[model samples]
Target: MIEVNFDGIVGPTHNYAGLSIGNRASFANAGAVSSPRLAALQGVGKMRRMLAMGLGQGVFLPHVRPNTDWLRTLGFNGSDTETLASAWMSDRALVANAMSASAMWTANAATVSPAPDTRDGLCHLSVANLSTMPHRASEAGQTERQLRLAFPDPRFFRIHAPLPAAFGDEGAANFMRIAPRSGGPAVEMFVYGEGQSGGFPSRQHRTASEAVARRHGLSPARSLVVRQSDAAIAAGAFHNDVVAVANGHVLFAHEAAFADPAALYAALAALVPDVVTIEVPADRVSLDTAIRTYLFNSQLVTMPDGGMTLVLPGEAQENAAVWAWLNELIAQGGPIDRLEVVDVRESMRNGGGPACLRLRVQVDADALAAIDPRFLLNETVCARLEQVITQEWPESIAPEELGDPRLWDRCARARSALTEALGFGTDEL
Candidate 1:
C-alpha cells in the first residue's frame, strides 16, 4: 500500500472529521460525474467544500452499551454521537443521548455534520437544547463575528403553509443550518421529508423525532428518508463534499444521506466529476446507526490571539484518530487558530453529540454568496421558518406540535437565553 504523507500541508491543519482519507490520491470534479438521482447537483460546483469522512461502520458487540471498554481496537460505540468528554478522549465512546437531556431531544440523533453556512461550526437540530444563538453582544469588531443568531421561542410552534403532505414533502428543512459563529445566514434543512417512509414519524420513535423537529421549528421533509429499496435496509441521508487531499481531485458525496449505499454511490459518481470510492465494511448494526444516526462534534472558535478549539472525535479508528492525530499536529504548531474540547457529558447523558445535534449550510462559492449573513440574527428566523413555505419543506410540524403552532414558542426564554449564551461564547459574569 502506498502512503500519502498528509503530515505535510493537510496534516498540519485540523480536521474535525475522523476522515483518514488517503492523502496521496488525486481529485476529479464532482460535476463531471453523473447520477440518476441528481437532475442537477445544487450543492456542488467547480470549487467544492470539504467533507468530514467517507462511509463509516461502527463495529461493536450486539446489545452493547454505547461507551465502554473491552470493545477492543480503537474504541468506538454503538451510537456515533457521544459526550464531549468521551469524544475528546484518546480512546473513548459516548452515546449521543448522553449529550441530549433538554426538553426537546430525539433518539435518532447521528452526527452534527459541520457546514460553512453554520459560519464554521456544528449544524444541529435539537429544539429542546437550543436556547440562545451565540453572539458577541458587546461591540462589532470589539468581539469579532461568526454567526448572529436570534433564537425564537421553541413553544411558538408556528406552522409553514402549503403542508408537506399536500405536496410530496417537497421543501422539507431538517435541523441542519449554518453556524452563526462563522457569521453566515442560517440555511433551512430537512434530514427527512414528511411523505417518505421515515418522512413522518409513526411509532413512538417516529413521533418523538417529529416532536423535536416541530419544537426546533424545522420542516419534516428536510430529513432525507431512505426511499423504499431492495437493499434490505434504509436510513437518513447527509449531503457533503469530500475533498481527497491526497489525490488533489475533489470527490463530492452526500455523507448525510444513508439511503441505498449502492444507489448513493452511483449518484455520487454522477454528481462528482471524479469518483474514488472510500468504503468501510458494512455491518447490519453499523448500517442501522448510519441510516438512523445523529452525532455532532464541534471546536471552539479561535480567540483574538488566534486561538480556536473544536470538539474532538472521541474514539479512535484504524486511521481515524480525530483527536489524537489532530492534537499532536496542533502541538507541533499545525497553524490551527486554536482548539477546544468539550465533555458533552450532559448531552451524552441524554444521548447526543456536538455533530448529531446540529445542522449546516451550502458552502458552494456561488450558493454561499446569495445568502445574507444577517439572516442568522433575525429574532424571528425560527418563527419565520415555521411560517415560510418551500417545496422542499414539510407541511406538518413534529407530532406534538404537528397540527399546533404554539410549541415553537414554548421554550423558556430566560432559560434558553442563558443556556445559549454559555453554549456559544459568553463567560460567567
Candidate 2:
C-alpha cells in the first residue's frame, strides 16, 4: 500500500561530467567540473541520487559527484540538464541493486512524525527492534528479522526492546501505527517536526506511535504537529523526508548544525506553515548548506507545460528572495512553469548550491508527466561552456583576461544574487 506522492525530486547534477582529477593530477583535463553538456546531465541526477537512499540517508553506494559547473552558470541548457538528467538515468536501480540499500521508519504515536511508507522499492519508514538493517543486531552474524531491517525503519506503533529515548533512535528499521480516525486513513497530513529522532522524549517513540495508531484504527490525540527541535538531529538526521508531501504540505529548514539560529527559528516555528517557512538566516552569509539540502540538492518541479520549476541554488539572484516569492505565487494563480537553480559556488566552496549535496527518490507519474518550460529555457549549456572557457584560456592568453573590467563587474554582481533568486525572465534566462 505504498502508493506514494510527496512531490519527489532528487539531484543537482547541472550538466554533470565523469572522469576528473585535473589542475595536474597529471592533467586529465575535464575538471572545471565536467561538461560536454554537464556529462549528459550527470547521467540523470544519478538516478534520483539512488532514490534518495530510501527517504533517509543510508546511501549504501552512490559515488559520482562532479557538479557540472553548477548547471553551466544556472541556465541549465544542454537540454535542460539533459531532460532532468536523462530522466534520472532512465529510472535507475542497478549499481548492484543500489548496493543492497536499506530503509524503514515508523513512529506516529499520534503525531510525533515520520510516516511515509513503502516496501520492496524500499521506503518502509519505522518498524523496530534496533540493531538496524534486516535487524543486523550486533552484526557478528545478524538476524532479528535481519537486524530489524538494518537501521532506518525507526518504529511504527507498539514496539519495545529499549528502542525509544525520545527517538534518540539507535539504528531503527521500520514502524508505524497510523491509519484510523473515525473511518481511519487520511489524517489530512501535516507534521514537519525535525529534532530528537523526534517521535519525542521517546517511550519507544510513544510506544511505537501508539502501536501504529492501534494498527490503523486511528485517533492518537487528534494528530498534527510542527516541530524543528534539533538536539543535533542524527539517526541520519531523523531519516530525512525529502521535502515530504503525502498531502501533508511541507517546507522545513532548521539550520542550527553550528548551533542556535534563534534556536533554529524557534524550532521551525513550532513545526511548519508560515507558507512552509524558508527564512534562511544562517547567522549572516546564509544558505545553511542549502537548508540541509532540499531533497538531494534541489526542486520545486511540475512542468510538462502547466508551469512551476525552481530546481534551485545556481544563483540567478541567489535564491532571488526565494524565486521571487515563488514567482509572485506563479503570478497570483501559482502554477509555476520554470526556475532551476544548481550552483557549485563558482566551482567549489565549502558547499554546493540548491542544498549542499543531494538525496531523495520516487518519481514516476509517467516521468513527471514530461516536464518542460522549454526545458530550463536553454542557451545551450551556457553557450557551450562559454565556448570551452574562452577556448581553453585564449582571450589573447587569459589571466582573468588580464584582470578587471571591474573584475568582470564584480563577477557580474556576485552572479546577480543567484540570478535574481531564479524568477527567470532575464529575457528568458
Candidate 3:
C-alpha cells in the first residue's frame, strides 16, 4: 500500500487569534499579524517536498471561514455582512472563533483505520467532534463533507460522522499505528489524557478513543489504549503527536511522552516484536525544550529507498539542544537516517508543526485510485496553486482586520478562485 499525506491547504483566514487553550505557541503569538499568502505557500512547498521524495501527496481545501452560518445558529440573524458586524460588536471573541483557520491542522480532522486493518476490509474514518475547544467544535460537519467527497467509493471507504460531542474526540493526533510495514495488519495505539493537567484541559478522552476503535472494528488484541503523561501535557504538549510519532516499525518519542513507557513499550513489542524505539532522554532534551522546539513533532516517514527521514520544522533546527541531539542521533546511525527541515514559521507560530499540518492515510492501489483526482497533487497542480495563492490570498492580516467585511469578501473570493482553479464547482467544495 502507498501511504499518502493529505495536507490541509492553509486558509486565507489564517491568523494568530490564539484560539487553542493549551497550545503554548498559539498563546504566545496571539494577536500578532499573520501572513496568509506566505502560510499557504509554505504549506504547498511542504507538499511539493513530499512529492519530490516520491511520496503520495493530496490536498484538503480550507473551510469557509468567518462562518456566518454558525453565528446565525447563535442568535445572530441577517445578511452575512450584517450578521458578522453585529456578532463582532456583540462579542469580539465570538467573531474570532468564527474566523479561525485551525482546520488547516488536518491531523485533528479525523481518525482513520486503513482497509487492511478493518473487519469490513474498507478504510474507516471518524470525523473528530473537537468539543474541547469552542472554536473547533464546528469543524465536524464540513470535515465529514470533504472526506465523503474525497473517498466516495463505498466499496473501499466508510466515512463515519463525528462521535457525539460528549466524547471529545480529537482525531489522529493522539493515535498511532505500528506495523511491520505499511498496508499490513498493525497494532493501533490510542493515547488519551485524564483530567486537567498544568492548567490545560486534556482534550482526548479514553472513552472517545474506545468508541472510535469499536467503530472501526479493531480487535482488542491489536488495539492498545494508553494514557498520555501528565508531565508532557503540562509542558504544553497539547496532542500526542507533539510528544510522539510512529511510522512503520519505528516509534520516535520523547522520554516523557507516555504515563507508563515501559508497559506501553512492552505491549508494542509483543505486538510487533521488531519495533525500533528511539526515545530521547530528558537530560538530552528536556520536556520544555522538546515542546518549545517541537522536536518530536517531526514527520517520521519511510523513504522510497527503505530508509526513514524526519521532516522537521525550522524551529527544531534553530534550537541548539534539539539540533545537537538530532545530529547525534544521525551520527549514531539510528532508524532516522536523515533530517530535512522546512520553514513553516506561520504555522509554527500558531502551534502546528509539519505532522500536524497533514493527515496520513495508507491505501492500496485500488483504494488510492478511488480518491478524488483534484485532491491529488502534481507539479502542475502545485504551480497552479501557487499562482492562485499569490494572486488572491491576503498578504497579511492583523487581529483588528478579522471583522472587516472587505477582508471577509477577499477570503471568500480566494476560496472561490481556488475551487475554480482545481476544476471544482462552487457547490462541490
Candidate 4:
C-alpha cells in the first residue's frame, strides 16, 4: 500500500485578487503581480521530488478560470468580448471571483475514504461543494469529472456528489486520516470551523462533516469530528490543513489548532496505541507567526525508510521561529527525520503551502495502478508539463487582465496544451 498524493497543477489564471477574504497572505499581496508559469513549475517540481523519494505521485488538471459556464450562471450574455465587458462593468470583483485559480489547491478538492475504511470495501471520494466562498464554489463540478476520469472502475472506486450547499463542505482540507501502519485500519478525523465565526468566515460547517462521514459510509466508531479553534481561524488559518497535519501515527499540530486538543489526542489514543502527538504551544510559535510561515501546512510524509519527511515551502526556511522549531523537532529525533524545502514562493504569496497543493489518498497497488498514466509524475511527464507551462503560461497577471479580450485566448491555449499533455478531455479545463 502507498499514500498517493494527487497534486493540482497551478492554472494559467493564477493571480492575487484578494479573493479569499480571510487568507492573510492573499489580502497582503492583493494587487501584486503574479507569475502563473513559476507557480505551475513549482508544483511540478514538488511532484518530481515526491517521485524521487520513491513515493506515489499523481497530478490533477487545473480549472480553466475565466470560466464561461460561471459567467453564464452570472447572467452574462452575447459574444465573448461582450460578456467579458458586461461582467467587468457590472462587478469587477465577480470577475475576479470567477477567474480564481484556487482549484489548484487539491486538498479542498474532495473527502476521500480508502477501501480499507469504507463499508463497501471500495474507495469513496466526495467532491467538496465549497459553498462558503464564491471563488471556491465553482470547483465541485469539474472536480467530480476529474475524479471519475481518474478512477473509472465503478466496482473499485465510488465517486459521490458534493454535500448540499447548506452543509458547506470544504473537502479534505478539513479532513485527516491516521493509521497504525501504512495498510492498517484507520481513524478518520473531520475538523470543522464553527458557523457564525466572529473574525474569518468558517469554511467547513459541522453538519457538512457529519454528512460526508455518512456519505462515505464510515462508521461512527472509526470517525471523530473535531472543532477548529476560532482563534486559529481568526489568525488566517482558513483551512484546518493550515493549522494541523497528520501522517501514519503522528499528529503535528499547534496548541490552538483545535477547540479541544486533549480530547482529539485521547480519542486517537483510544483507537491506536502509541499515537504521537507533537504539539507546538502558542507561546513557542505564535498563531500569527505560524500562519505567516505555514509551519503546519508542510506535508508530513512517511518515507520508504520508515522515517517521516517534512516537505515544506521555502517560506518556512525564512521564518526564524518556524526554522528553529523544525531544527529542535529533528534534534529530538521524533518521527520526522528529514526536511525537503522547495521554492513555492508563487503559491506562498497567495496563502497556499506545500500541503495545500496536494490531496493525499491511501490506496493499494491495484488502485494506484488504475490512475491515469499521463497524470503520473515521471521524468518525461514532468519535463513535458514544465515545457507546456513555460511556453503557454503567462509570466505575470493582474486582476484587471482577467477582462482583457486577449487574456481568454492565452488562457485557453494554455489549458488546451495542458489537457493534451495530460491526456484529459476538452471538458477537463
The candidate that achieves the highest TM-score relative to the unseen native structure = 3
TM-scores for all candidates: the values are 0.30, 0.22, 0.99, 0.97
Model 2, CA-based lDDT: 0.28
- lDDT of residue 300 for candidate 3: 88
Candidate models: Cα lDDT each = 0.24, 0.28, 0.93, 0.88
Total clashing residue pairs per candidate? 139, 94, 0, 0
Candidate 3 Cα misplacement greater than 4 A, ranges? 181-184
What CA RMSD would you report for each candidate?
20.8, 22.8, 1.0, 1.3
For candidate 4, the per-residue lDDT at 93 reads 87
Ten contiguous residues minimizing lDDT sum, candidate 3: 179-188
Residue-level lDDT of model 1, residues 295-390, one tens digit each, is: 122321223343433333232111233334444646865334344433333222222233322222222333233333322222233222222212
Clashing pairs in 4: none
Pairs with steric clashes in candidate 3: none
| 245-317: candidate 3 lDDT, tens digit per residue | 9999999999999999999999888888889999999999999999988888888898999899999999999
Q: How far out, in Å, is residue 115 in model 1? A: 14
List, residue by residue over 120-214, the lDDT tens digit for candidate 4: 98899999999988899989999998888888788678999888898889889899888885446789999998854556799999999999898
State candidate 1's TM-score. Answer: 0.30
